[model samples]
Target: MDVGLLFDLRNPAQWHRPWADHYARTLELCEEADQRGAGGLWFTEHHLFEDGYLPQPLTFAAAVAARTRRARIGTSVVLPALHNPVDLAEQAALVDLVSGGRLELGLGAGYRLPEYQLFGADFQRRFAGTERNIREILRLWEEKAVTPLPIQDPPPVWGGFYGPRGARIAGRLGIGLLHISHAMFGHYREGLAEGGHDPRSARVSDLLPIILAEDPEAAWHRVAPHLAHQVNSYRQGSVEGTGRSTPLLTAEDLRDPNAQDTRGLLDILTPEDAAVRIRELTKDLPVRHLIFWASIAGMPDDLVTENIRLVTEKLPPLLR
Candidate 1:
C-alpha cells in the first residue's frame, strides 16, 4: 500500500497558536515527509468554519508542489459543487506541471449544506453537478486549446464516494474511487463492474484517521479531544441538513475527560500495533493507497510531526 499524509489545516480556537503558524508548519512538514519517502500529501477542503478550515486546497497544493519533489500533491476532496470546472481544471493542470505530473485530484459532492449555500451551489443537484464537472475537466485535459498542458496525460482523477451511487459515477467516468471506510470497498468494486469496467484496473484509496505513540493510553488521551472536535464539527454543521449515523462518543461524551467508551472512535496504537492493523487491510480491501490524517483538530505541531514520522518510517516496511 502507498502511504500518504492528509492535512486539513484547521486553526482550532483552543489550540492557542498564531493563526499563520499552521500553514508555515504544514509546508515544513510536507517537505520533511517527502524527504522521508511519503508517497503523497493530501489536503482537505471546507468553507466558512469558525477557525478557518482550508477552503482553497488546490492553492495550498500548489505551494506543496513547489516545496516537495517526491510526494504526490493532491486535494483529498475538492468540492466541484462550488467551482467552475474549467477554472478548476486550469488550476489543477498548473499544479500538475509544477509538481512534475505528481497530482491526484479527488473530486466530490460535499455533504455540508452551508458550504453549498455560501458558494451558491445547489445542494439538490450536487451529484449531477459533480458529474458534469468531471466530464468538463476530462474534456479540457484532452483538447489541444488548453495551454500549459499537464505533464501527466489525463492526470489521475479520483472521485470521492460516500455511497454506491457515487462509486457508480466514478467507475462510469473511468476515474479512481476514494472511499472513507473499508466497508464500502465492495460497493465501489461492484460499481466498477456495473460500469462495464474491470474492477481490478480501477484505482481505490481511503482516508483513515490514526494516531501512534509509545503508550496507546497516552496517545488515546492526547488525540481524544481533537478527534471529538473533528467528529462534532461535522455533527454540529449537519444540524439543519441530513446527518449521518451517531458514534458511540458524541461531542459531549468526548468533552468529558472521564468518558470510558471512546475505544472504537479512532485507532490509537503503538507503531508496531498500527503497522499490524494496516497490514490486515490489504487482505480485504482493494486499496492502492492509504492516506492517514495525522494533524487532526489542531493537534500540536510537535505531536503531528512525530505521528507523521512514525507512520512514514514504520508502516511501509511492514507492508513490503
Candidate 2:
C-alpha cells in the first residue's frame, strides 16, 4: 500500500487563522508532500460548519493537481446526493485531465440532515438517491457525455460507506470500497459474488489517523487539544442527523486516548510503531492507498510541518 495525505482544511473558530492563510498554508504543504514522494493527496468535504470545513474538495483538489506531478490526487469522500451528476462528472473530468489522469473519485450517502437541508436533498432517501447519482456519474464518464474526457480509461471510483448495504452497492457496481474491517469486507465479498463479479477483485482506500513522531508522548501533548476540537466539531456537526445532543468535548473529556469520547482516535506513534500499526490494520487486505491526516484542527505550524516530514520522508522506508 502507498502512503498518502488527507486534508480537510478546517479552521475552527477558537483556533482559527485568516481564511486565505489557511488555504495557502495547506496548498503549500500539499505541494511539499507531493514533491517528497507522498503517493496520494486526498481531500474530503463537509459544509456549513463552525470550523469552516472544506465544502468544495474538488476545487481544492484541482489546485493540488496543478502543483504536483507524481502523487495521485483525489476526493476521499464527496457527497453525490447533494450534486447534479452531469455537472459533477464534468468537473471530475476536468480535474482528472488537469492531473494527467490521477483522480480517485469517492462517493458517499451523507448522513448530515443539516447539509441535506441546505442542499434541498431528501434526507430519508439519501441512500437510494446517492447510489443512483453515483452510477449516473460513472455512466456519463464512460459514455463520453462530458467534454475533455478523463485521461484514464476511467478513473477509479470508491464508495465511502462503513456498513453492509453500502458495501453491497460498491461490489454490485464493481467499484472500490473505502471502509474495510475483516467483518465488513466479508459482506463486500459476498456482494461481489451476488453481483456475479470475481470475489478476488476487491480494492480498498482508507484512512489511518496518526501522528508519527520520534517522541510519542510529546506529540500527544501538542496534539490533544486539536483532537478535542476535531471530535467536538463532528459531534456538534451531526446532531441533526444522529438526533444526539453531545456536549462539547474538552481536553478533560479526552485525557484517556482509549476513551470513546475521543473517537477521532488520533494515534501518536514513532515511525517504526506506525508502520507496524499500518500492517496490522491492512493485513491480508487489498489496500491501494493508506492515508494519514496532513494536519489536525489547525495544529501548530511546527507540528504540522514535522508530521508532513515524517509522513513523506521517514515513514516510507519503514513501511518497505
How do all models score by TM-score? 0.90, 0.96
| Per-residue alpha-carbon lDDT of candidate 2 for residues 163-282, written as tens digits (9 for 90 to 100) | 999998888877888885777888888878888889889998787878877788887888888888888777777785666797887776776657765654678888899989888888
Compute the lDDT of residue 149 as modeled in candidate 2: 87
Q: Each candidate: what lDDT?
A: 0.81, 0.86
Query: Number of clashing residue pairs in every model?
Result: 0, 0
Candidate 1: clashing pairs of residues: none
Off by over 4 Å in 2: 241-243, 261-264
> What is the C-alpha lDDT profile of model 1 across 1-320, one tens digit per residue?
58899888887888856866878988898999999999889987888777688889999999999999988887889988789987898999999999999999999988888889888889989999999999889998888447878899988899998787898888778888887456666677777787787887767787875676667676666776777777777666765355545553454575455656443456757778877887776566667778888687887666787788877887778677
Best by TM-score: 2
Candidate 1 total steric clashes: 0
lDDT of 2 at 18: 97
Best by lDDT: 2
